[model samples]
Structure formats: C-alpha cells, structure tokens
Target: MYKETLSSGIIIVPMQQEHAEQLEALQRIVFPNLAEEELLHADQYKKHVELFPEGQFVALDGDKVIAATSSIRYHFNLNDNEHHTFFEIMGGGWFTTHEPNGEWLYGMDVSVHPDYRSKGIARALYRARQYTCKQLGLKGQMTVGMLNGYAAVSDQMNIDEYYKKVKNHELFDPTVSVQEKVGFEIVGLMKDYLNDPTCGNAGAVIVLDAGKAI
Candidate 1:
C-alpha cells in the first residue's frame, strides 16, 4: 500500500471502500457547479478502488476526507490532436476504460475541500499520483485539468491566447497554474471538455514524466 504524511499533517493513502461516502460529499463541496452525474457518487468511488486501487488516492485531515484524486491507466499517446470530454473519459464515473496494460496514469479527478485549499493538500495529492505512476512502471501521469480560472477572463481573450498566457507565466489559472507549480507542464488545450461554466467548459492537458513523479 502507498501512504504518506505531509508536513502540514494531512494523511495520503490509497482510496478505500470506506472512504466512498465522504469522498462523494467532498465532491459536492469542491465542485458545486458541476452536475450530479458529472460528479462521482459513492458507488462510483467504490468501483474506482475495485478497478484500480493503486491508481486512486485520498487525503485526510483526521478522519475527514479533505481531498482526493481518482485515476485510471490508459495507453494513449499524450498529443495535441487527441480530444475527449470529461464525462466520456471517466466512463460516467465508473472508470470502465481502465486499461491494465496501459502505459500512462490518467487522472480523472483531483479535488480539495474549500477550507483546505492552500494548505499543501493538492500538492500532496499530486505527489501521491506521481508516486503511484512510478510504482506501476508507467510512462507518466496525465490529466485534463479544467481551466477553473478561465471564466474570469473569457471576454478578454480566447482560450488559445489565454492558454499561451498561462503557459508563458503571464496568467495564473487556479487549476493549471497549481499543476505547473507541482512540476507538470502544459501540452495542449481541450475544448468542450466538461459541463463547467466556471471554466467555459474547457480543459488543459497537463503531464509529468515518470522519472520526475516522485
């Protein structure tokens, strides 16, 4: 089993069946604008552990599920031409597309409770994902990060310009910028990525290599 305790006192561990309900509740708190179907309910969380326990993780403050990240192994080459929506990629929360022989760990979701946003919870969760990737001998960790800050500047620029600005360090995106801080890099942008008004329903594909996972 994989586990770690950050300096800030949060515990990171593999997601288990017992954590399902709290995780479901955590999702609502972190992403209030998303539809219920887009969020993984309790049953889906259990299925995630069942399908790929090694690829899923949660961060806890005491016994409360304060943060989590769900992932699946997939073999696709991380490229600019590829495209897929969050719902279709997540298999509607069931993670049915998890390929046992896949070469990459695909992050389906990573969320932190509002009260614990800047306490290193997200960075810890990401490190856990990278640790899992190296353990599985995967090529790297990949995620379609929702452009959570895009909505704030939508009228000022198009998604492409916004992407360049963020990539160039001229803009700060709540989600992507944080991922970059943790050593992931911007590779491409995804449009109509999810039903998220806050992000203009777009996503950015970010990646981190296996050698750098830990």
Candidate 2:
C-alpha cells in the first residue's frame, strides 16, 4: 500500500484487484501490437497481486490507471546456459515462475498509456522498483527491454549494432533508450522475445544494479 504523489498530480500506489480492468484496458493502448496470447487477461491481475503484491504498481490520475509495472522474483544468472525467452521467464504471464527466495527482480512489463507518454510516469514507476529492490535487499533488476521503433532500420543494421547504437546514444529507440537513461545496461539480446514484428523478434537483456540506485 505504498503511495507517492507526483508533481503533475498523478498518484503512484501498489496495484489492487480493483485495478484489473483498468490495467487491462491501459495495456491494450500501451502495447497495441502485442499478441492476444501474450497479453495478461483481467483475471490474471488478481493472481499477480496475490503472488507478489509488493512488486506490482500502478499510476493513477483520479480513478483512471494511466501507467503500470509488474515484476517477479527469480534466481537469475546472467551467464546461465539456459537461454530463457521472455515467456519462459515470466511463466506465461501468470508469473508462476516467481521464486520467493530469488536474487533478482525480473521486471515483467512497464506500460504507460498512450496519452501519458513523455510525462515521466515510466521513470517514476522504475524508481519505485528500485526502492523495492533496496528494501528487499535484492541483487538488482532485470528486464527484456523492447526495441521499439527498430523496424525502420532493421534492414540496415543487426540487433547487436542496434543495441550498441542505443547504448552509445547513436540511436533513439523509444523503449531501450529510455531504459538506458534509468541505469539499465544491455547484457545481450534474445530472439523471439515477443510477438512484435517491428523489433525483428528481438529484445535486449538489460540489468540495473541495486547498489548504484541506492
């Protein structure tokens, strides 16, 4: 039941079952290209809260949910041999993979409504994640960041080069660039991370150290 008020009057708080429908509606707008199978249905939100309520959060303006982020705990090793895809790591959207004694917070998704873009809502959600990591004494945070806006240049560059460009500030990927700004570093890329054709069926493995955030 954490709460914070942003300067713009948006309120950030732990997600509740009451927010399920609003969260599902916002997900449609925020991730319009996501496959139906990949999207979490409204009922799943209740499972998320029951499993790990502390890692689920939402941003609201009045009664409307404008942004949200979900995370799960997992014993992750960056050098592990198992080449887990996003779906495998997330337990098919139900997050049944969440391990109670895990070392890292695996960020499942961070979404902001189309109307709330560029308003710092996403960053605020990330800061909340960092706070959670610090409080729980977790190692850090991990995510498969979307390479939004990568389709336009996919024919001109490979995924690695595109990631480098985003890291070096040579490219302005809508998702990765913003993630890099918040301290996540690209460890590598994964194939078939999502159903989005725009990103060339790739996603970046990004990590942020909790000590640095603290």
TM-score of each: 0.96, 0.94
Tens-place lDDT digits, model 2, residues 1-214? 5788999999989999999999898888877888887787688888999999989999999999999999999888888625676677778888899999888999999999888878889988988888889889999999888888689998999877887787678889988877888889888777778889778777888899998652
**For each candidate, what is the lDDT?**
0.88, 0.86
- Backbone clashes in each candidate structure, one number apiece? 0, 0
Best by lDDT: 1
lDDT of 2: 0.86
Candidate 1 — which pairs collide? Answer: none
Q: Can you list the residue pairs that collide in candidate 2?
A: none
Residue 175, model 2, lDDT = 88
* Alpha carbon lDDT at 206, candidate 1: 88
What lDDT does candidate 1 reach at residue 158?
A: 84
